[model samples]
Target: MGCGTSRPRLDDSDCNPATGSTRKSAAPITNITQSYQRARCSNTNPQRSRAIGRGGDAKPPSYEREDPRRPGQAVLNILKGGLALKREGTVNAFESCKHKRILVLIDDNHKMDRITKRAICSLASFILLIGHGYQCDMEFRWPGYNNNDSPKLGTAGSEMAKALQKLMDTKTWEDACEMIDANDKLQEVGLKTWVENQLKWKPSNDQFQFAEQYRHHLPGEAIRVANLKGNDTDEDLHRKLRVEARSIMAKHIAGWAANDIDRTHLMKLDTEARKKSERDQKLSSNLGFEYRKAMENYEREMHLGADGTPTLVILLVASPITKTEKDSIIDCQRNIMASLGTKVANGSRDAYAMQTVVFTKSMASANLKHFQDIDDAFKGHHDINDLTKVEETKFCKNGPSPELLAKIFNSNLSSIDKSELGERELYSQEILTDGKGDIQWPSHEDVMRTFRPDDGDSDSEG
Candidate 1:
């Protein structure tokens, strides 16, 4: 029979035509050999088939096989002109547009310089390309960014396009470093890695809420580096970013400390603020007409006016203790504030008051975001005793400065009675006291009475 055009083979038994390849004889082939053979065959296929099997390779299939784009070249062409680079290299170019924006996604751990260049270049190209082609938006997605497993683009296709335009135009490493270092999340995931990992994790509904809630607590640098797409196009966006970044860093650092330390710091901040406000409030009130009228009852208690301005001081405390115990401590502190409010008004003989009162909020918020930093301290099984040194130092550094206190007092002088003030105590007596009753000091009469306690009826009655 004549050779058929559809099928032709030299050996029917030994040759393997299963893959449409000419196998000289049946020989066990390794994986590498099989791959090479399949590629060779696919290349020799019809034009349509060849195009269909183009992206089969060891790395990601999206990488082109025959493209001439070199490493370090702008990948914008890939997104814009439907181009792909077969080689592995990084681009260090930057471009900008007058008013248009271009999205540039990259591996988060990629060098800041490189990312900056790509962003600038992409933006410039976007301005030019979109101007002529379509006047539309474009998105860039870096895979495996910020612990993300997949890829994502921005809603408006990367609002960072404009900011990047500015960054490239200015080319300020100092500014970039300042911003990056200030970021709380940047420290956690690292600068370039944030971008890459973000590719893996898409924003879910819950995750979006979570990010929004804690967004204010991150450092400016961290937020800028973490999410560059907050394109509000307002000057306040930068200010808000700066403030939020600082708050995030504070919260994160607090989390790194042990639960006790975290809780203590939170309590300290809240206590100090509340004390100042209470002092002002009680002082104001006392200085008011009501205090003037009530002071007639007690000359000693009449001097200072009541100050009742409410102040907000929130402290986030993370503790290793049971939640119930933490709640109890918080409750006790609140009760102290409540009790002090009454004592300030009634004029008990021994009723001494602080210009500011100690009211603490939970430290749970601060410690939650930065547990990794302080994990060692918390896990070492240290008790409250271990906290003395740290707390003392922290109190000295972070506690209200005498200058600030003076300012507050000076500002509210009308209500605050500075005359009765004495040496400041480091720890509140309220903290040490059990609050059940006053500690007793026995007298000589009591000593003799103990010996005379043999009177059964009298002793029983006592």
Candidate 2:
């Protein structure tokens, strides 16, 4: 909920869901891997449209939608079914009271006759108890096994103790009550005496006074009103009314305490909710700031100079690069520029400022050669080796080849700087002896004469 602001609508086809004719792959995509690949295409734009009869024979013909026979889809369906089975298994185990076994692991008996019957069929009996978290301790004894007489008692006791401990650690009274309420076999217990005892204690001393406030009903209050039977008298129904009132009150009280509900708890909850709201607001603000900051950084990366005038126009340049490749290349380029920061020769103040232009497919296609020239001037990212090393281990199951990548790079190089290279000198020669080399070296006088100004009449007057 506190994530970044919604981005502006770019285009219909740019979204993942909007991409046509793509099937969900078998292997799940890893977040780190996805991010790495995205670096290469960060500044590039998606290709507008596939060229007809070119670039892999104009998108393959649409096949009939595979039904229950589709390989990938079938695997996915099976996976979903497996997950469902696991959930069902967990529920079945709980209902059967499999958790009741082992000493000191008691379960609240449910009122449902069917559930208890099922548990009995499975040779399990749960002791009904109330309250939340670690409600009650149990001492379990197997039907055929004697705890005191058996030679394996110590081991059995230890195992049972550990099992119970684990169950109690995870189970709660609220969960127990919900489970018990689902059964019809268990009878509801009244809390009239318990409520009276609770009330007898001073409100100041009672730790659960806040919980009692909502739960404990005062004497003589009606639990529910209903039409009386024709033969039933007021006195006969009075006893029934009292039982119902106590049951209702007991249920409420049990629920409140079991859920850790109190005035203090409520106040704490309110405070937390308020803090979360404030945090969300702050997060939203931060996201806006980050977006602006990222844009500013991008601008500086593209523009070569600190001059405020925007040099690079935001364009829809076509990129053959995938998301993964884009992210990698961007990271590589960033690192390379950082390494060369001090070494790069700057003729003017503006020369040092460099901003990278993120382009879309349309922009790349509109002025492809010029952009390619610009790319060439930069000589491509030096970190191309890093990507190649990655490619050695990780192969794209479905993707364009590195040759295609190189082709895209070459094609885009024409759009960048137009320059020719001169023969590189390995080393400058030093004349140890004047006659050591056949090549004639310039004398000091010759060098001076070459640099001298032409003679003029004004110089003669001086």
* Best by the TM-score measure: 1
Candidate 2, residue 289: CA error in Å? 15
User: What's the TM-score of each model vs. the native?
Assistant: 0.14, 0.14
lDDT of 2: 0.25
Best by lDDT: 1
Question: Against the hidden true structure, what lDDT does model 1 obtain?
Answer: 0.27
Off by over 4 Å in 1: 1-178, 181-186, 189-231, 248-462
lDDT of 2 by residue, 1-462 (tens): 000111122221211212222334344433322222222223223442232224464552322121222112222222222223222123211121222211211111122133221222111111111111123222322111112322333554434333322222223433323333443222233223332333333343354455346435634332122112213343333333333332232212111121233223322332343343343221111212222232343335434444433211111111233333344434544555565564333321112122222222223343434333333334332211111111100111111122221221122222212222121211112211112211112222222222232422322320
Evaluate model 2: give its TM-score: 0.14
Candidates' C-alpha lDDT: 0.27, 0.25
**Which stretches of candidate 2 lie above 4 Å from their native place?**
1-366, 380-462
RMSD of each: 35.8, 35.7
Model 1 TM-score relative to the real fold: 0.14
